[model samples]
Target: MLTSLYVRHFAVVEEAEIGFGPGMTVVSGETGAGKSLLVDALLLLSGARADSGMVRAGCERAELAAEFDLSALPEAREWLRQEALDEDETCRLRRVIRSEGSSRAWINGRPASLAQLGELAGRLIEIHGQHEHQALLSRSHQLALLDAYAGHAELVQRVRRLAQEGRALETQIRALQGEEDHASHLALRRHELTELERWALAPDALAELEARQRRLANAGRLAEGIAHLGELLDGEGELALRRTLARAQGELTRLVALDARLEPWRELIDGAAIAVDEAADALRRYLDEVDLDPARLAEAEEHLARLHELARRHRRPVDELGERANELRTELEALEQALAGLDARLAERDRLRRDYALAAAELGASRRAAAARLAADVSALMAELGMPGGRFEVMLETHGEDTSLDLLGRERCEFLVSANPGQPPRPLRKVASGGELARISLAIEVATLGKDSVGTMVFDEVDSGIGGAVAEVVGQKLRALGSRRQVLCVTHLPQVAAQGHTHLKVSKENVGGQTRTVITRLDEAGRAEELARMLGGLEITAETRAHARQMLERAQAD
Candidate 1:
């Protein structure tokens, strides 16, 4: 439940800290005294849109805060725990609106987004504006209210989920069936695969083939070069390296016999002659192996040209042709598998349809049961709220079996009403007067009591278009609802104001030449004076004061 609200530089409210208690609390004041400012403040704290105009004239920003006790609100506590914003059993929500049209929010002193604040606020309080009856006219809103009253959250969510899944499955099925030309696609892929396979070459094999081509292409040059090298190393001419080295070695041997130091030089010349002989042998072996084969070279060049052409056609590197062929093979396999799996997918779609039908059927049945109870309860409350013969009904119109899946179940919900006896119940939006709509809306709200999990319910002038006994009944209904949950009502009706377990008086004052709105919690004497002011209009007489006191006493006695 809401524990307190703090506002500073917010609109005409310069600064105010008001503590709230459980049960019905009525806020009353003269018109234009900013009676609904409290409600507006709570709305802003709940993440409503804010603007620079909401700030006071001399202030840079508007600050609003609300505190809640979550001892009985497990949902709120769990939400706090999930968000890591839990601070014992109390939660504080703060919002700052700058004069520049930017705003910031916090939950338990932790910076939070507007969406987060709204989400948490939803679990803490529910504010019903004076114009809420306007929304109640919408068929969708009516259905939502019925669902809430029926405690069909889990069931409605299930039906919606099944319907969504079924629609998604239907979309998949359509996409699969839309592939009517799959056979042609498969044939094209197979033809491409076959072409790729025909010229597929491993990377290493391609490298080796290119090397062989280079070697074969230069065979004549290589043989000529090797023959020249052999002549230079071991030819029979006197100038050849081998003969020169041998003659040098003979001379060195003759010198070595004269001096032992010359023996090492003679051994070095012998090693040179042996190295020249080894070179000549190696050149002879290489020249013997050299082949001038144009046919093999031509074959390798044509193969490479074809591979490059294929790479150009496929927009891939020549080395990646093998990988491309593998990819095409996999695609062909998938095409075959997709064709084989079509029947299975169709079967699964059927299963989803069946599941959706079952869930929607159950939802429809529950709605019918809940609708009966809700209509009866609202009708009974309508009689007590000064509509003697009025009747309320929840009409469900079922859709055809072939209709597309709907997230709101298989039927359309419409609220119908009859304001007079012997009259047929008509759609609420078309027939009910504004006062009647307010009463009926209140009746529905009262009928659905205890169904909402929100701990606090705020009604901003919910008694807008009714008066006298009807207003009294409205107050009683709110007071009764407050017994189970906290309720705050902003009203001008004396009867309604007198019904509050606590009363707050809103008044405007000019302080320091600046207009400000002030809210004061009323003691018994203060309550009587405020009520008398509401009952007596601009002036309060002794009789009006006595009447106000008696009204408060009577409402409390009840």
Candidate 2:
């Protein structure tokens, strides 16, 4: 239930705080008194779009806040707790709109996104706008209303889940078959896989083969270079580097015995001779191992060339050939598996379709039963709400009976209404007048009241174009609804105003130099006067006051 609303610098209202109670609260005001502005502020707190124009002319921003008691709204409280926005047992929704058209929202004083505010608002309040009859005309909302009234929410959810599961399976099977349908495309991949398999490729094998080929190709030149190097270093030749270094070292050692500086030169000559001898030994071993075999070299070259050709054919680098081979093999294995399982997948799809069909049939039957009960119940309430000869019906249109699967089952639900005895039932939108539409909407809501999670219901001018005894009945119905849940109705009818447990009057006046709208809760005497004003128009005569007091007495007696 809404506890209070605080508004500041919004539209024509400078500042006002209105308090509300549990049962029916009716807001009534003269024309052009900005009563709708209060509704607009509530809408903003409920995540409606903010308009810069709503800000007062002298103010930079407009601020609106609403407090709701969550004791009876467990779902809303749970939402607040989950979002970490709870504040004891109350939920505070605040919205601020800047003159520049930007806006911000807060839930229980915690910053919130507009979507979060919207979600919480939806769970907490159900606003039946003056134009809400348009929603009654919507097929989806009509179906929802019937389902809600018949307690078919759980069953509908089950059917939706089954349908979703079936669709997922069908999509998977289609994707696999889509791949299988391109058999010709898979043919090239098959050839690539076969070529890679024929070589038995490994990542390092190609490089190793290339290295061997290089060694074989240069074998003769390598042997000659090593022999010549050996001769220069230590072989029996006049220019032997090791022999010359040894003689130099012996002379330097003898000189070092005479002078210390000669010792450093002796060390240098000795190191040079040692390095030359090591090189000559290594060269001799290499010369002995070197082999010039044309046949082995040709075979290595041919193997490397074949690997390179495969790389080119696959448009891959030579080193990546082995990796490419593995990828091709994996893909080909998957395709083979898919082909093998095609028949099994088809069988499974058929099974899933059958499952879906069974669930949908059950759901349809439940809806049919629920629809009948819903039409009967709403039609029964219609007469009391001011539509005496009205009839309500639920028309179900079925589709996809011959197809494989469907999402919202096979039926489409629409609401049909006959407002007069001689006329046939037509779509609700086409047959009901504005006043009749509001009454029908009221009946439907009353039928499905407790089934809805929303704790607070707002009716904006629902009594429009209605008066006299019908208005009194509307007031009674609203008061009854309010007994179970919070109801806020905006009306100009004194009958409805007289029924409120709490009455608020909206009025406009010139304050200081500015025109401002103000709302005040009225006492019993004040309520009588307000109702008298509503009844007598321009002047409240003694008889009008007496009638207003008697009306209140009669309403209380009922």
Candidate 3:
């Protein structure tokens, strides 16, 4: 339920904050008083398009905000939770349009895109008018409404799932016959798998083999390096650390006998000499093992080349050759198995097709039954809403020749209508006048009460061409609808305004040479005065006031 609306600098309305309660709220005023501005403000808050034209004159931007109580709207609450926009049990929608034609929106005080705002607003409100967002203008919405009436949700879901599965199977069958069935492709795949199997590659085999190859390639360089290291450590060279360290240790030992303070220096030189000898011995052993073998080097090079060629052929790096081989092997095995079970796969596909056909048939049957009821109910309501002898039909056209799968069942739906007797029903969109469309839309909405999940419904002058007794009937229907869900009606008929649980009168006033719109909520006495004005027009008489009072009393009694 929408709880409040605040509008600032919107069109001719400078500022207005209107509070609404649940049930029927009637907005009425004289012609050209901007009664529809309230509805427009709600639409903007519901994510309708905004432009500089909506901004008030002398104002930089127009701001509109609405608050909805979600306590009774579990679906809305859950939606907020899913979108991470929940603010307790309330939902706030705000929109701003600048004079430069820039527009922005926010949901729950968090910046939101137009799409998000529209999505949330769709679930929150449904506006019926000559505009595009009206659900009655959409054939898909008609079909959905009929399906909801028939409780076909589960059946429809099953059919949709079956159709999706059929599409996936069709794709797989095409691949099997088109791409994977080629003899040349299969032969190449087989050869690759055989080569990989023969090599039996391991994850780290390439790295290990390459390291061994490097060692064999540089065997001579390694031997020379080892020999030079040994010469530097102990050979008969001036830089031989072992020979020099031995001479230094002998001199230090003689000095220590002369001066006991040099004993520590002698010990340090002896340790250095021993360490050099040990290093030279280790180097000699390493040189002995550095033997060059061309056979081994060639073998490592050939193995590394084989790995590289396979990697390039498979469009992978040498390090990932093992993983690629495993993947190819798995795919080849699966393809071979699939070929063996080709007949079985075909049989399974046939079974799935049969299942899908069965589900679609069930769904179609339910829809046809529901369509009958919907047509009957809407036609009956149309007669009461001033469309006497009007006929409404829910036409279901089946696609019997369609062989391909579709998620929306195997039929199309159209809402056909005829406003006069002896005329065949035509598509609802073909109806010429806006008045007839509004009435038809009203009948459908009234008949489908509790079928829609939207919390609020707005009717923009739907009673335009209606008055007298028919206007009274329209008011009763709206009141009944309001009893079920929140309803806001912009009406000029006194009868409709009298039926509202709450009434607001829109009036235009000039202030400082500027025309501005204002909305005033009417109390009991105020309601009677407004109703009198509506009934008597520009003149208010004592008799008109008495009649207005009687009308309100009678309406309340009902």
Candidate 4:
């Protein structure tokens, strides 16, 4: 239930903090006095789109806040708990709209996205605008309302899910059946796989092959260079490294005999002579092992050329040839599997269709049962709302077996009505008058009350085309609904205003050369004066005041 609403710098409303109670609250004001501003504020708090024009003329932003009691709304409380936004048994929703057309929302003082605000607000309040009844002319809207009244959310959702699954299966079957040349495609893939497998494309094998090719290509240069190195290190010439070291060793050994410090130099020359002999031995082994055959070199070069040609033919880098081969093998495998499973998929599609049919039939039966009860209840309400001899019917047009299935099940729903006696019922859009439409819309809402879990319901002048006894009946129905859930109504009829458990009057005034809207909760005396004003227009006669008081007293007594 809504506890209070605070609005500041919103349109003509400079500032207003209005307290609300548990029952139906009616707001009344003269035309152009901004009576609907309260409803607008609630809409904004409920995550409606905001506009810069909603800000007061000289203000930079508009602020709107609504507080709700969650003790009776466990669903809303649980939602808050899930979102980590709960604060005790109360929920506060605040929205700020800047003059630049940007808006921000908060839930329980924590920043929130507009979608989060909308989701939480939907569980807390349901708002019906003045033009809501106009939607009744649409068959789709009528179907939705019927479903809502029937509480068929779960059943309808299940039927929709089954139908979607069946459609998806059909699409897959069609795609597989369309591939008529799978045999040829598979053969081509197999040929490509064979070609890729013929090459040594694995990373390790390719590295070893390239290394062998490099060694074969440079064998002659390597053998010649090593031989020259061997000659430089240990040849029999006088300038050879080993020969030069031998002479140095002899001279150093003689000098060492003369002075012991010379012995370390003689040892260094001997170590150098040994290193040169080892170098010469290694070169001799390398020259013997090196492959200097022209035939092997040609073979290595021709093999590398073949690998490059394979890379070019496949339009892939040499390194990626292995990956390409794997991809082709996988595709060939999948194509073969798809060809073999075509019959199985077709069978599955048939199974889904059968399942969808059964579920749709069950949903249809539920709708038929709910439609009868809803039509009876709405018809009874029509008579009480002054449409004597009126009848309402929910017509279900079942589709044929050949018709394609959709999310709306196998039947279309439409509302039919007869507003006068001795007349056959016709479609609501074609037969009902404006006043009749409004009353019928109200009857549907009244019939569907308590079906929704929302704690509060707001009607923004839904009583537009109604008056007199019918207006009073509308007010009574709304008031009765308030007994079960909180209701807020914006109305111009005294009959409706008098039926409120609480009354609020909206009035516009000019202060300091600026226009502002004010809302005040009405006491018994204040309610009488406001009702009298609504009843008598610009002049409030003594008789009108008495009549207004009596109406208020009578409505409350009822």
Candidate 5:
């Protein structure tokens, strides 16, 4: 429900705030008193189009802001949650329209697009008038209302899920069908992978063999270095030292006499001779261990080349050749099974389409049944609203030849009405009289309000054409409707205005050469004056005031 509406610099309303409560609320005013201005601002807040001409003459821009208490409206909360915009259990819709025709929207303090604001506000309020009641006359809207009346949301949801699944299946089938002419293309790709599949490659075989090849290519230098080292350590210096030491030892016997240092020199030469023999033995062992093989190295290099070439062609690492082979083999198996799987999927799609047709047909039958009840209830209300024998018809036409797939369950529907008794029933849009049409439309709306998500219903001058008892009946009905939903009525009739749980009167005044609109909530005494003014026009007679007081007392008694 709307908590308050604030309009700043909009039309004749420089700044105004209107608070609303539940049950029937009536707004009464003299002509050109800005009651319609209040309604217009609300319409903009509800996502209606804005006009630059309505901006206050001196203001650069006009701002329209409306606050709604949505804690009780779970559907709206859920919608906001889905859109990720629910904040503080309250929805604040604001719009800024520049005098240059630029407009902007905000939801919950976040800047939003006008389209988004419109969608969000659509779930909040519904304004019904003689001009906008044509929405209930829309055939598609009527079908939705009928479905809602039938309480078949679960059934419709099931159908919706089925329809969604059927669409997905159809898309998959078409994608597979598009691939039907690609068998030759697939075959070529398979052959390419198969060519690269037959390779016997081992890792690092090339690098290891090349290292061994280099060693073999330098075998002569290694052999020469070994021989030269053996000659220097054994034959040249170590052997000569051993022979000289033995000679010195033999001479030392006669000169043991000369010094003990001579004896130490002989012992050192003996150690050197042992070292020379050990070095020559190690060199002989080293020469015996080197075996070079060029042919084996060549074979490794050739195999490495084949693996590298295959890897490059496939854009893979050389070590990944084995993995590539396995992948290609698996893909070949899948290709062999593709035809069977595609056939099964296509068959399943057809089966779901048949199931969808059956379920949707049942739903369509249920909607038709519900539509009849709706028309009867609305037709009854039309009679009570002073349009006796008004004919309200719900027409459902089946479209397309019988087929598995269809457009919107293949049903085209229309809601038709005739306002007068014995008058040929015609399309509602063809009606000429405003008040009769307004009543007929409201009757249908009240009947279908249960199916509609509109939390607030505003009726502008719907009680225009009738008076007295008829006016009382209209007020009673509007009041009765208040038990189920919020209703705002703009009226001049005392009985109608007196029907409200809260009444507000709009009046105009001239202050400093400018006309301004003022809205005041009527207290007990003020209520009598306002009601008296409504009953007796500009002059409030004593009798009229007394009558107004009595009317207020009677209204309160109810």
Candidate 6:
């Protein structure tokens, strides 16, 4: 609840601090007394746009601060916990408006933004006025109100969670479909990979084929060189080196036999003769085997050309062609497996959508029942507020069209109203008069109070229309509402003002030709005088005072 409010340097307010409690507090005075100015300051503190005219005439700036006790609001406390903004059990909201038309806002004494303050203020208080009939015009607000009234916020939350899950699953299905959509790419990749696999090129195979081509290109020259060497080494009739070495070996043996010291030369001669004979035999065999075959050379060149062509076709280094082929094969197989997985995922996504639909259906059913009960409750309260024959209705409509193999689950709900019997209930915007609408708005507030968690409800001229009994009933409702939270009502009706737990009289006073607004708490006699003044105009007669005292006594007794 709002524990305190301080206004400094505001229009006609100068400086004032008001203490609040957990019950109805009434602010009353004649016209132009700055009573509503207090409400204006509070609205600004709650994140309303600021106006430079609100600053005191002689001051450079205006400041407003309001305190809230959050010990009882667990939701707000948890939010504060998540944001790390809590300080003990209190939250302070402040706003400063400068004469230059600039404004600053704060929460918990730290610099803050208007949006932050507004978000927190929404949970802390609800200010209802004539302009908020737009909320009645909104379908979302209607559903929220009825959901709050029927105590089905939990189900609404469940449905929201399921909706989120369903959307996530649907996103995955879309991504899978995107992969499946590239069918042409998949087919082309498979065909290319299969062709590469069939070739099974080996590393350096191109270089090996090139080397064979070189060997074939020089085969005739190689064979001719070997045949000429064989002829010189004894393949033809000539004195070969091997025959000359053999004759020299026999002469050395004769000389070594004559001289015993010459035995090393005999051993050398024998080894040389053996080496010469082996060389002659190898030369004869070389001449026999050396022959050029152009057919085989052509075969080798063709093979090399084929290898080079394949390397060109694949657009890779010949050595890397093998690795590229292996990689392509792996990818093609993985894509084939991924397609199967995509199908499975899409099927699972379909099942998830069905589950979401079932959950939403259940949620819609609960909301339907809840809307009826809420309409009944608010209608009853409205009747007690003196609109005896008013009719209230809640309507729901479903969506159509199937998407992604599943139907979407959703519906629109509207609040309908009729001011009197024999009249058909239409949309709230079309059917309700200003007074009836204000009262209806209050009844809805009252119906949703326990679940709303707002610490204060400010009624701006809620007692504007109707009189006598209806006014008392409005006062009683405000009082009962105040039992759970604080309520501040601005009113001219003495009956409504008299019922306040604390009565404040706002008046305009002048000192030294400067007009200012003043507020004072009225005691019992003061209350009577005020009520008598309300009832009897400017004359305060003895009978009028008696009647005022009696009215006070009865009001206080209740």
Best by TM-score: 3
User: What's the lDDT for residue 483 in model 6?
Assistant: 72
User: Which runs of model 2 end up more than 4 angstroms from their true locations?
Assistant: 1-8, 14-23, 42-50, 61-98, 102-124, 132-135, 176-359, 418-426, 429-436, 501-505, 509-512, 519-533, 536-558
Candidate 5 deviant stretches above 4 angstroms:
132-134, 188-340, 404-408, 429-432
Q: Rank the candidates by TM-score, best first.
A: 3, 5, 2, 4, 1, 6
Please give, for residues 1-558, the per-residue lDDT of candidate 4 as tens digits: 999999999999999999898989999998999998988888888777889999998789999999999999988999999999999999999999999999999999999998899889878887765433244567876777778787878888887887788788777777777776777777888888887888746888888889988999999889889988887888867788888888898889889989999777788788888888898898899899999888988887887787788789888888888998998888888778877888988887777777778888888898899999999998999888778888999999987574355788888888988877888989877753555666676677788774667788877776776688888998999898888889899999999898899999999998999989989888999999998898896778999999999999999999
State the lDDT of candidate 3 residue by residue for 1-558, as single tens digits.
999999999999999999999989999998999988988888887777888999999899999999998887887888889999999999999999999999999999999989888888877888876565676677876777777778778998998898898888787777777774467777888888777665536767756887889999999999999998898898998868888888898888888889999988888888888888888888899888885999999988888788777877888877776677789888888877877776777887888888988888888888898889999999999999998999999999986545567788887889999998999999987787777887788888888884777789898888988889999999899888898889999999899898999999999999999999999999999999999999996789999999999999888677
**lDDT scores of the candidates, listed in order:** 0.86, 0.82, 0.86, 0.85, 0.76, 0.76
Model 3: CA > 4 A from native: 57-61, 69-90, 108-111, 168-208, 254-266, 321-345, 388-390, 400-402, 420-426, 430-432, 509-516
Which clashing pairs does model 2 show?
Answer: none
Candidate 4's C-alpha runs over 4 A off are 1-6, 15-23, 42-50, 64-96, 102-126, 131-141, 151-158, 182-344, 365-403, 414-439, 450-456, 483-486, 509-512, 521-529, 536-550
Residue pairs clashing, model 3 = none
RMSD of 1: 7.4
lDDT ranking, high to low: 1, 3, 4, 2, 5, 6
Kindly give the stretch of ten consecutive residues in candidate 1 with the minimal lDDT sum: 128-137
Task: Name model 1 segments beyond 4 Å from true.
Answer: 1-3, 44-52, 67-125, 132-138, 151-158, 183-339, 399-403, 417-436, 453-455, 523-529, 536-550
lDDT of 5 by residue, 181-242 (tens): 55785786687676665553445754565576666766677788887776665555645544
lDDT of 1: 0.86
Looking at model 5, the pairs that clash are 255-258
User: On residues 452-522, what C-alpha lDDT tens digit does candidate 1 reach at each position?
Assistant: 57799887886776789988998999898889889999998998888899999999999889899999999
